[model samples]
Target: MTDTDVVVIGAGLAGSTTAAILGRAGIPTALVDPHPVYPPDLRCEKLDRGQVAILQKTGLADIALAATTFDGAIRDGKAWIARFGRVIDKRPGGQYGILYDNLVNVMRSAIPPDVTNVVAKAVHIVTGDDRQQVSLSDGSTISTRLVVLANGLSVALKDQLGIERTVTSPCHSITIAFDIKPRSGRAFDFAALTYYPERASDRMAYLTLFPIGASMRANLMVYRTMDDPWLREMRHNPERALFALMPNLRRIIGDVELVGPVKIRPADLYVSQGHRQAGIALVGDAFASSCPAAGTGAGKVFTDVERLCNVHIPNWLASPGMAVNKIEQFYDDPVKREYDETSKSWAYRLRSMSIEEGISWRIQRRLRFFVGAAISAACKIGVISDGDQFVPEGWTQRLRDRT
Candidate 1:
């Protein structure tokens, strides 16, 4: 049996970052993962400016930025991508575009050399008053003061620990990812672009196009059932189905050909309850899964690692045994609570914005794109100065009231 101060399961972004931070602080931390090399996974393709800031706070900003780089875009007028790029370039910490697997590997590789890397699955976790015991597939055990669960959506570990998730929406949204290249074999004019859905029948929230490496990646997000005929059509004939769903994509990205298979993921919104247990804590998707459309997964996960590693854990270890009260502090953290609540609200908003057939939503949807285009036009003509506060106060809520 080996012993450590903390055992971080699931060597993903959240887990690896936590272990790295603790190890840097000279804490005895063990990171366990089934695979020595993280398998290719398709999740968040790009990180917005806000998420970059959060990673900066965790001291992993350089690691993340180096993993991948791409230009940022917003759905404004035709020139919006240019304007957005200028702003991003001027910002302290700009956005990033990296594949999910590359991002996770970069974080894992950055873990301090002192941290123990266990290449085995954590079969079971048993928590107690003074210590927690984690049984691995190799028939070895690790006794630690705290356990950080960052295994993402897999609930087997949580189930053994008697934790249940409160699913707000099952199959809340659908995401399809694939690679595309210009038909003429020429590079795209822009580094990235966001194309919004123009028709209700498309049932799409938006289509994001960005460069991952040598090839351009396309991620189309929509609010529809997996059984929907369109999904099947997309899987069978992605080239035609995708362009049909979002005709504006061709105009924005130019003529392109599919270079890979269509990858589909049905996102579900869930928050783990009954996780404030002694000797253990949950973070990332294990604690609460976010809507991919909302783009809050990285933010929430980074915040958890930041709070736990920088603030809560140090204070807890300075004293005695890991108690329920000590672990509860992480759950009740104001920043963490805010991130959780905001993620839920964004999930509801993104879904409602896409599929709600009500009159109010109809008007809001139209205005959202219209206002964005108008702002972009204004910026181009110098009607609205850069760095100025726009958007008339009370105008947004008044529109919601149908005033």
Candidate 2:
């Protein structure tokens, strides 16, 4: 039997990040996972600028950025836009493209030397007001003050503890991933490209093209069933199915070829029920599952790790034993709740905006793009105050004065 102040189950990004933070803070922590070298798993491959900012706040951004190669621009079929510069200019980071397993390894590598790393499955967990005991499959036991569940959507652990999942949508969205290659046997024109669904029948949300190391990767997001024929075709013959669905991308990609097998992921939205218990807490996908189309999966998990490690855990530890009241404070946290809600909302929006045939959504779709275009035009023409004004900032002003 081994004992520690905190024991975190699952050493993926969420658990590893939590362990790293708590370990660095000089807290006795233990992180356990089934795989010492995590195998390949499909999830969010790239981190947007917004997600990057949250990671930056957690002090792990530099470590993650150091492991990847990024040049800071993405082309969305039309033209190349400086994604990091336009949205998060105040911060100096860009969209980062990294493999999911690589990311988890990088975070796990940052786990403090003092924190214990247990390589076994957490079979059962028993929680109490003062202490929690976790039983590993290897016949070892861990007794700790608190247990952090960062495991993704695994009900066996939660079910044993009498926790239920209130599912919002059982089969919310479908994601397909494949490698990108040029038919001419050369490099692509752009570093990255994001192509939106062309018509209503396509049933696609968007297709993101980005680089992961030397290989270009394409992730196609759609709102469809797992058994849909199109999905079958994608699995059997990915190249043809992909081109048939998003034909407009042919021009941008020139001649395209797919390198490996097409991977399919069915995303389900759900929030854990009865998880705010004494001496135990949940984080990352264990707390809630978000739609991949919404691109809120990583952001929500980062928020969970950030809030739990930095704010709530410190306050919880300063007191006596881990109680239900201390655990509830984290579940009721304003920022964490907001991010979870935003993910749910965006999941609905992405599905409706792609497949909804009603007049309301139709009008909304047009207006959304129109508003974005109007804002871009306003920024370009230097309309500072009113509609018909050309007031550029800094260098443009100096050029106007010279004229």
The top-ranked prediction according to TM-score is: 2
Give per-residue CA lDDT, model 2, range 95-134, as digits (tens).
5788889999999888889999999999999999899999
Question: Residue by residue across 1-403, what tens digits does model 1's lDDT show?
Answer: 9999999999888898898889889999999999898898878887865677678888888877877864543222111221211211111112367888889888888899999999999999999879999999999999999999999988889999899988889998888899988899887765665666665666777776676767778788899887899899998988889777765556656678888788999998888878889999899998888888777888888999999999999999999999999999999999999888988887888777777789998898767655655654565577864333464432332222121
Name the lDDT of candidate 1.
Answer: 0.78
Highest lDDT: give the candidate number.
2
- Residue 215 alpha-carbon offset, candidate 1, angstroms: 1.8
All candidates' TM-scores?
Answer: 0.89, 0.89
* Segments in model 2 whose C-alpha atoms lie over 4 Å from true places: 71-93, 379-403
Q: What is the lDDT of residue 295 in candidate 2?
A: 84
TM-score of 1: 0.89
